[model samples]
Target chain A: MACGRPKLRVGPSQREGGFTDSVPATVSRMENQSMRITALIVCLPLCAFGAATAQGLLLQRAGSQAENRPVIPKASKGDQCVADTEIMRKDHMSLLNHQRDETVIEGIRSEPYSLVSCVNCHAQTDTSGQAIRIDAEGQFCESCHSYAAVKIDCFTCHAAKPAAMEVIGNAEPHLMRDNPHTLVSYLLNKEANE
Target chain B: MSRVPVADNEKSLQARRRFLQGLGLAGMASMSYSLLEVKAKTPASSDKRWGLLIETEKCSSGCDACVRGCNEEHGIDDAGDDLTRAQWIRKIDLKDELTGNETSLPVMCQHCESAPCVDVCPTGASFKRADGVVLVNKHTCIGCRYCMMACPYKARSFIHETLTEQKPSAPRGKGTVESCTLCVHRIDEEQDRQPACAVKCTEEAHSAITFGDLNDPDSSISQKLNTLGGSQIRADLQLNTGVRYQGL
Candidate 1:
């Protein structure tokens, strides 16, 4: 844990405005006495109640914090995450946003930070053995996001689950340059015919 | 021509040397061709302009294979009535008034070189990829539907209802305008697959659709265009659509 330097508290004597020193000492002393008495009378019950409530909430939170921690689902494929847990927790959104632009506009799809990769590794399976969406309730992305109270708009426009295996693995025959009717073949055929 | 008379031994040696040189040249040429073929399989780049050639004359009326394939690939089911349903590709029948000649063709996003949808989008959501595939970035889409109004081909569709079970490759949602992506996901993938519509059409033996890189002069689609010629749907608009139609 990193420790922060303590901030200096500048009192009225140290302030650039020395107007407080111009007041009569007797008048200032009487005013300070009356203000202190009024504060004690007004804040006694409020501070006591506030402190009791805060203590109770803090105790409750401390006891349940471990139980309330997000239940991260086990990854389906990789033994380790693409990034450190701390780095990903803080910077995954920016990484995904940057990658999305690179892909959508520039047509550079080979980047490592793709949202599809996240879904592929994190999506969980239900009791029926069907793959559940990563953003579904109690799932990988949702469990943490709901605990943090941060609503994500990603799953709204993006898929929450990985694509079916066949969809990714099915390799159909390409019919472009390989076709016999291509320009080179067409020219060659024409020349042969001639 | 008179052959130069050299020693028999020297003549055989020269012949062997020539044979070795020819073999080396052949090997180099084959290696270069293989290298070029391997390079072509990489993801889309600015150097390539992917497009489709639709032979309308071969497209049979009432054939909805392309439409069905597109819907299935994108997981777009019947979320609403016909008027409200999102259609990425649709079959349209055309008839000439004077000659009474009938034609049928599949109409989708033209993927214009200077797309009006890209121009009209307020949020810069409707954008054309460097490889010429136009797509809607649903994350930034404000659902204004200005792209729908600006499109001359009426290709764009507005998603009105919240959607679920969208294909992982093709993510879509409510309150956004979308259109045909030309199977950009498939194009980006390292696998050897064409667009679903073109694949289905070829499987059905119609062979009416041809997807290829327009920038590659050696491509079959470019060769066909150079020889037979194709027409844009609205040529007067000067949009320079990537999708072309033959025998229109």
Candidate 2:
């Protein structure tokens, strides 16, 4: 009745008949049962050792491929970030959220935790010195975010590059419309169309 | 032309006269007289209500400089069809049916003190700032369009398509209702405060729009409003809109 099935108590003679093929027929029933228990104990460690070795090999392979990890770009502006690197890595979302509320809701724009500042410092440049967007493929934000499988929603509305970055052949004045957001792409497409 | 008759009552006139007299004394003393001296990097305070006064008589009907300036400023002209494109500011032509007189003015968000948009927003996205700038917090906005329905002036526009090349200062995207921010970014950033439309209007030589703190009696907008008189669109609603029109 233990486990919803009738637990029939097998006698030593019944066990002896059941184990006759596996255990030697001349061996005593007590000795046979003890040897079976010994075998079970020995198999457990062997299975665990095999699994441990497999895990160790995986760890070694991963460690050797360290260069495959996300490459964080150096900040172009300040010597250091507004916060420590480790702190920024962990708490940048909360910091940006706090600053967003202050700037957007309260109309306080001077704080250093702004997304614009992050782009100004972190955005990279191309061969001809045109600023590359931080969220573009293999770029600053994308490197880590794509590796971590985290989707960035900020650049959907916010510019991914600094506003002052110059795009080649754009004759427009450096006004708000000339910001390096879609304007660069828009002008480039227009140039292509022409 | 209809006049709003603001501060026209005997008691209000007496209070305004006393304020002007005090301002005159303060100005004569050369103490850099200002009700609220705004500093850099600070949140806008309730003490100063930012507003605009558009002289309709001066606003030229054919000119779309203000509209163009506003669109360029916010990066709203890049995409979307004419039917769905967001218009933060628009030039409206008004004609007096009986007298055959015509008036032209730029219309945008009125930034009402008791904003219907602020009232109807289910997610509290439409809110009035401390300085009385009604704004839509797109982060909280669910694109319900309830605020658009409630608004009397038809100020707000719903962004329909995915936007690109958004300005760093004005971050607009699809699935959120937006309106004229009254150039809140310029007011916050630049030392010389003027919305893009106002700046463009001035650049175009119309100089029809005047932006200043309505609470400051010494401010040009309030002073001009006090003397020349101004009227709000749909004044019967009593929203007490921050944007006013003169010679309407």
Candidate 3:
């Protein structure tokens, strides 16, 4: 007098034959949950490891190709720079921003850090010997900025190329001379000879 | 042989003494030169307040040499039509109300002591340098034309179109208000060099504009202003402009 179906009686030998009639329902449920937990624990680390290894390989492959990396131009003044390459590569924007304030606001137009000075040194020329614009592709500023996915708007208001000639009638006559440091050197040498 | 060594020692001692003396002299000279340089360059403490004295009597009725010079200096010759043109300086003709005679004079940013344009700028992009030269910092200018509206003389202009081939000394661009900077680049580089307009005027033999320090009594412009009593364009505003006009 079962509710729906009549229960068929099986021998005790058939208990391990994938029949859960003798096993407690609670024990079976717990076993299923434990199996799921074990699967997740085993699979999670394996998936993560796989993803990380794949990413590492991709990065290594990209790194091996020069085209994937940013091309920094050789400095006109050999390896001399206002700052160390590592520091400049990381924090150049901040330094330039601070320098802009100093030059524009305070009127401190010192060399090697000024925008004009940077253009004088870093501005590159094509085969025709004309200076390239700052925002041109493959140019010194654009190449690095584009590779880093940064947008630079400095060339919009600033001259992208170095001035062909220095502005006329500089206040310091010595500075205008062909050999600017000659006077200082001469003085030093005269002192040495004396 | 012993006497020869003695002589050599004496000679070396004399050379060392002379070297020390020369070093002392050079140090003194450099120290003095540096002191002079500081006095000359320091805008705050300097007794030289730069100004322009424009003798309207000498200004020709139709000549625009000053304006042309300014245009060439700033590379604004190609600035498009009348409305969008960057007019650093302009020649304006005025008819006398009583005399029925027409006179012309060059007008530009007066470089006021208490500039309203500087006051109204939200970002302080419009600023007066320590030398009293009013200039716009294009880096901070947000294309807000508050300075243009605030100017009493209508001296400022907003660049509407993109600029190209700008002079290296004058870095102007689109979306920024600009006005006469009194050739600040030249002033910074050369104390003796006049503003382009003044130079052009002299070259043309008009000699209408004279540029010199107002603070120094010995300066030619100061002497002329003191004796001739020049007038500011908007004297009612009490702006105390650096540029002054005579025979207006």
Candidate 4:
């Protein structure tokens, strides 16, 4: 209300110029304040943008933990995969899907991409020598599938381990052991007694 | 070596003709031997079509050796009721009304050339292998039971409950359709061994069921079919079933 100069009466700088000075000390102080306000207005958004960029980088680093990495099993026979590592990582599911159709519809059992062959090579065992099922944590198929958030329905109807080692201590060794036809001969012998 | 000099044109021409005749004879001998080898190896093809022949007259009414063998091979846990149980193979008792003639025989999947179950399957889970063995790929099965409805022999069964400790060769689980695979795992693994049912029946002295390659003219089933002539059940359907019955 007082011509926007309310601090004029209380200022020592006002005494230096008195009434003769056109540009008063109070006006200069006001200008300084306006400059500070303009600087603050310009710098605040830039500071926020910098902080946001730093936060995004931190999140990305946290997301790349070992739990999120693909769990590729160590090959028993050779160091290399059937396909290149990058190709297998990208297109394994599609390859398996195509192989399933070939095996089921066309009866082409000689393909190298069979799921049973995969299980034979990749299935691991615990310290106790018991087979780790496909759904178990840290297992080859489950670990990668869980990391990628994909549901696996293969173990529902297919064995997760090799045929020979699956029934190790069982009485019916012929069911899945090395000699697959032993059961037929056993049954034949049993029926001979009857 | 000593060489006798003769007339230039006549001797050289005679030598050339003998050399050509010798080459032709060698080629003919090799071709004839290769043809004989091919004929001899026809029975050993992996693509050979496998089938079963059942002699119904020789099958005993009460003996369940084949059924027991199949159940043991697959680890089929016995359910409380017949309707809920999983039966891969079963004994069927047939009677003719007019003649009052009765016979008992074991029955399972016929492995049709054009399977109705394969035709009606929504997921193409029911399929016939190149070797004429019909099988159900349970991974693609959605428990829709369409295959079960389309099967003429009621060979397929749906698992209503979860199963554990399954055989590695036969991984059965809940909510899928399964059926007789004709012991395909055994067939794939062993060259000389027959199916469990056939072996059991033969050892039990019934000798009613015979398993062999249908494509091989020298196979036992083919020779028997040639002499005794077999009949296919529901031949009117034109399924051309792999399993044939003698003395039906």
Best by lDDT: 2
Clashing pairs in 1: none
Score residue B58 of candidate 3 by CA lDDT.
96
DockQ of 4: 0.10
- TM-score (chain B) for candidate 3 is 0.81
Higher lDDT: candidate 1 or 4?
Answer: 1
**Candidate 2, which segments miss by more than 4 Å at Cα?**
A1-52, A165-194, B1-40, B78-80
On TM-score, the stronger of 1 and 2 is 2
- From the highest TM-score down, the ranking of the candidates is 2, 3, 1, 4
Which residue pairs collide in model 3, if any? none
DockQ of each two-chain model: 0.16, 0.24, 0.12, 0.10
Q: In model 1, where do residues sit more than 4 Å from their true spots? A: A1-60, A165-194, B1-44
Report the C-alpha lDDT of model 4 over A1-194, residue by residue, as the tens digit: 45775663667756687565765556667787999999999999999999999999988888877446776667433344556767677868865776565445444444455676677557776789766675678778887888889999778666666554323444344543343223343345446656
| First chain of candidate 1, TM-score | 0.59
What value does the lDDT take at residue B136 in candidate 3?
90
Could you tell me how far off, in angstroms, the CA of residue B69 lies in candidate 4 after the best superposition? 3.1
- What is the RMSD of candidate 4? 19.6
Per-residue lDDT over A53-103 for candidate 3, one digit per residue giving the tens place of the 0 to 100 score: 999999989888666787878754334556677766885676577546545
Each model's total of backbone clashes: 0, 1, 0, 0
* lDDT (CA) per prediction: 0.77, 0.78, 0.73, 0.71
Residue A107 of model 3: what lDDT? 53
Is candidate 2 or 3 superior in lDDT?
2
RMSD of each: 17.5, 12.4, 17.7, 19.6
